[model samples]
Target: MNTRDLQAFVAVVDSGSMVAAAAKLHLTQPGLTRRVQNLETLLGMPLLDRQSKPLKPTAAGRDVYALARNVLVAVDELMAAGAPDSEPSGELRIGVPPFLSELALERPIDRLRDAFPRLTLRVTAGWSPALVQGIERGALDVATVMVPASA
Candidate 1:
């Protein structure tokens, strides 16, 4: 299967909306749909439940989603290994608690944007526990959590 097709499928599942996924990938909606359909065709099963308000994955799609995430991560690492000095691009998922997001991250985030113009940052704000959970689940690449000083 094509990596682009897998990427498209993962993006669609991640965003839960074709329009959002298409915009994220810089593809037209029709193009995104076709890629996903291509993947579904290869698998011989519908990956998305079209009847839902926001698209959701079918059971097989969930399994594919998990595997695809690992595949994408591995592919990225493999490419990076070959180009040690390559300019960073693609999505960076970050998690921060709402308070920390308000207080500490603005300047650093701005510097990151300036340094890697091609990189897309997708940030999620939540409680520290949930943010940690996100990182563990691979939903977040990195996160900041407050630890008690006494601990």
Candidate 2:
């Protein structure tokens, strides 16, 4: 019915309990429960199956939760954009080791998206020596290289 209701429901789904979600939202447990209940009433369907362990969301809840998460993510991006001191924005040229590209790129890329939504990440993948060379030549702003201890 509203962002507040949807936020409470999503928080409950994410936190796995009204008590936990309440703490996360800084609301009383009863208040969070009533917000979720209000959402269910407005939708005319139950969003949560309280009988399930870990408090699984109902099928309808899953659908609404996904949309709510997207809405919240966009809201977060908007808030970040308005807070210049808290927001980081720039272009970063990063040279990554070839193997690490497949092994470790996902999380860092996601973090960059979440933390610096306005920033651009230019990534070049190659062997450590090549990446290091790029960094040394100032072609890359940052590079990660793994080498033998003797080097």
Candidate 3:
């Protein structure tokens, strides 16, 4: 229902117990449990099997959990993008030819860091085919590949 509830649910899933989730979330166990309970109440179904030694998600829980995780990720990305220009940060995954990567990345990366201290740049170097595959697979957001002039 809310970010806190979703976060609590995720923490419980990750930690495998309410106590552990509370510790991870820096909240009291009861508070964390209540958050999870509230979420289940809102959804009108039990999310976790408390009888299990290590809490396990029910089928419904697993489905809700997946959606909650995605929602939280989207919210975080939205918040990050909406942040002020002072916090100009993004993850840029790029693929480049080995030689071009070696030559071109240094000065541009340095200049980018100077301009936007929080920016994170990830560069992967590979042959043309691999670079192109990475781009197609979405592993690389952008890529530069060399093709024969005749082709």
Best of the candidates, lDDT: 1
TM-score, prediction 2:
0.58
Candidate with better TM-score, 1 vs 2: 1
- The sequence of per-residue lDDT tens digits that candidate 1 reaches over residues 99-126 is 8786688888899999999788988899
Clashes by residue pair, model 2 = none
Cα lDDT of candidate 2 equals 0.87
Model 3, stretches more than 4 Å misplaced? Answer: 86-150
Better-scoring candidate (lDDT), 1 or 3: 1
Quote the lDDT for 62 in model 3. 96
lDDT digits (tens) for residues 1-151 of candidate 2: 5788889999999988889999999999999999999999998999999998789899998998998888876776777788868856656789888888767898988899888897888889988899888988988999888999985
lDDT for 73 (candidate 2): 64
For every model shown, the clashing-pair count is: 0, 0, 0
TM-score of 1: 0.63
Clash number for candidate 3: 0
Error of 3 at 82 (Å): 1.8
Please, what is the TM-score per model?
0.63, 0.58, 0.63
